[model samples]
Target chain A: MSALELAAAVFLLAGAGFYLAGTLGLLRFPDALSRLHALTKADNVGLLLVCIGLALLAGSLRQAALLLLVWLLALLAATVSAHVIARRALADGAEVEVRDGGGP
Target chain B: MRLGQRLVRGIVLYFALLLVWIVLDGTGDLVVGGAAAALGAWVGLLVAPSKPVRQRLLGALAFAGYFLVESFRGGIDVAWRAARRDLPIDPHLIRYRVSLPPGPARTLLAGALSLLPGTLTADSDDEGALLTIHAITPDPVNAVRALEARIAAWFILPREGAEQEGPT
Candidate 1:
């Protein structure tokens, strides 16, 4: 495989790792509040990295640029939408129940 | 302030936005584009009939900052819930009565509530005096109570009429 191909693979793998980390965080975190922090931050970063990797692998400047634009737009929309929804949830009054074992 | 100052501020903000857009798009020719955008915005603002709402800059900024942080927190919470195999969810519909009257304040409250984890705006009736919410985690009473408390803090008003009831 070419150097570009190798770089693409690495980026993709790194992104997959991030996604896995987010999933584990979701499962392992004891409380709702803490878990939220782990999933949102990790998954967002993971998806971004994966998109960048795929864009690089496209092997054409025009195609890569288009992919990058799409990625950027998607990220912006996701971020804004996430923020809006979370604010709404807070307004709706959700709470993190205290664990019996006193661990977050 | 004179009309000219308002015009200048609007022009500046518009031009700045256009420039940012150009950089992101990589169109490479910004002078003409920037001028066009600024002119368009200027004309639109001049023709717009509605008066701008008066907001205390500090208060608005604080509210925005708080909303940004809370939304981030909420997004993570939702993602976690979505990934779980055993959905530890207690879905229920709740109606919350709020203190803010039916204007931007109430709309803002409703909009903000729609973002948090496990809660969706089933309906917002009577200009946001009442909000029907579907929550994944249930506990309608407490959810409404907490939501009201947070909103009250953000909007700087005590939610006097806030109450919640579980769906039938």
Candidate 2:
């Protein structure tokens, strides 16, 4: 494979890894809120990397712009939904474990 | 002047929608694209009458840069923690009182915090006075505060007199 193709493959693999890590976080995190963080942040970065890889592979500016647009919309949806879920959990009095010190 | 402002907004929205149509259509068909864009703009105007706030372009660019960097950091931080078998996390909620007004600015702040480092805006009171933010880190107060300042500066909201300092 060409060097560019190799680069794209590497990005795609990294993106998939991030997505796997996000799912692992969702399964392993202690509570709803922490899990929300895992899902939103990790998935966002994962999708972003995937989009970039795909855009590079596509090699068309218009398609790249559209891919970026899709990423933006997904980011928006993820942010809004995650906030809503977290808010509901908090309203339900989801227990939170607070630690002392190490805060400025 | 208000009519003129609305007219200008309508034209801008028309062109923006038309660009989207062209991108989606991918055929350079101006006639259909123009009609669709016009319809879309009219529907947009009818549904959302209020004009968006004037954005400072430089400030927005700066905010975007900061957001991108912070989001990257946030993703790596979470991934690192998730990778650890020990699961080092000290989750807590803090009722953070922000200074931004109760409309778009406040909403933007909440959205920004959720995607930032180890912090998520779980809930805010009815009056938007206190935000119940969940943080994986021990101290998210300073980070939240810094984000608040960044947003305030980005939107060019007045810092004095309108400040509503609530309990932390």
Candidate 3:
């Protein structure tokens, strides 16, 4: 594979790593709140990295610009979405049993 | 009103957008790119809603920050669930009122909801300001609260006014 392709692959892999981390968090966390937290961080970072990498590999200006635009829009959407889900979980009566009344 | 103020804002937003474009595109010609951005912005203004963009802009940024943190946490949770080899999810339907109320603010909230994982807007009523969200996991209360906080923060809407008890 070409050098650019290699870089793109690395970026994509790293993005996948974030997804893996998210999945791991989802599976391991004891409650919904914790799981929601994991989902937001891993997926958001993963997507951003993957998009940037893809943009780098993209051959045309228009295509790359479109990609960036899409990435930004996705970022905006995801950020709001995570909050909504988390709030919903809380609203649904998910108890926070393990807190020391402070940071973790 | 003044040329300079409008020019400066336009230039700043243009640059922000252009940088994204350049990164996505392998090459850039300053002249052609500048012309294209100018044309694009002009078109953007025409097509954009008549309402002011400032509120929406601020709301969008706040939403972005909120999403990043939540999705990260969500990813970890998903990972853990997979490792356990059990799908312990208690999916259910949740109906809640949207606070931002009918306009750009409301639209932003609706659009953002679709992107979040494990939750879907099952139904919406334009006049009632109600949204029925389907959540994949057990907890629905927190999900609605999170929605409330995020919408309030982004749109600067008052929670007391926008808040309504969830439909049971």
Q: For this target, which candidate reaches the highest lDDT against the unseen true structure?
A: 2
**TM-scores for the candidates:** 0.50, 0.89, 0.57
Report the candidate with higher TM-score, 1 versus 3. 3
RMSD of each: 9.8, 3.1, 9.0
lDDT of 3 by residue, B61-163 (tens): 8777887665544554444554566655544556666655456656655555544545544445765367655555566545555765676666644445455
State the lDDT of candidate 2 residue by residue for A1-104, as single tens digits.
98888888888888888888888889989999999998898888889889888888885777988888888889899889999999889779898864432221
What TM-score is obtained by chain A of candidate 2? 0.90
Q: Measured with DockQ on alpha carbons, how good is candidate 3?
A: 0.14
Clashes of 1: 15
- List chain B TM-scores, each candidate: 0.60, 0.83, 0.69
**Predicted structure with the largest TM-score when compared to the true one:** 2
**Higher-ranked by lDDT: 1 or 2:** 2
lDDT of 2 at B66: 91
Candidate 1 local lDDT, B70-149, one digit each (tens): 55555555555556776455555555656554455566655555554455554555555666555556444554445544
Please report, as a residue range, the 10-residue window in candidate 1 chain B with the lowest summed lDDT: B159-168
True contacts kept of 2: 0.50
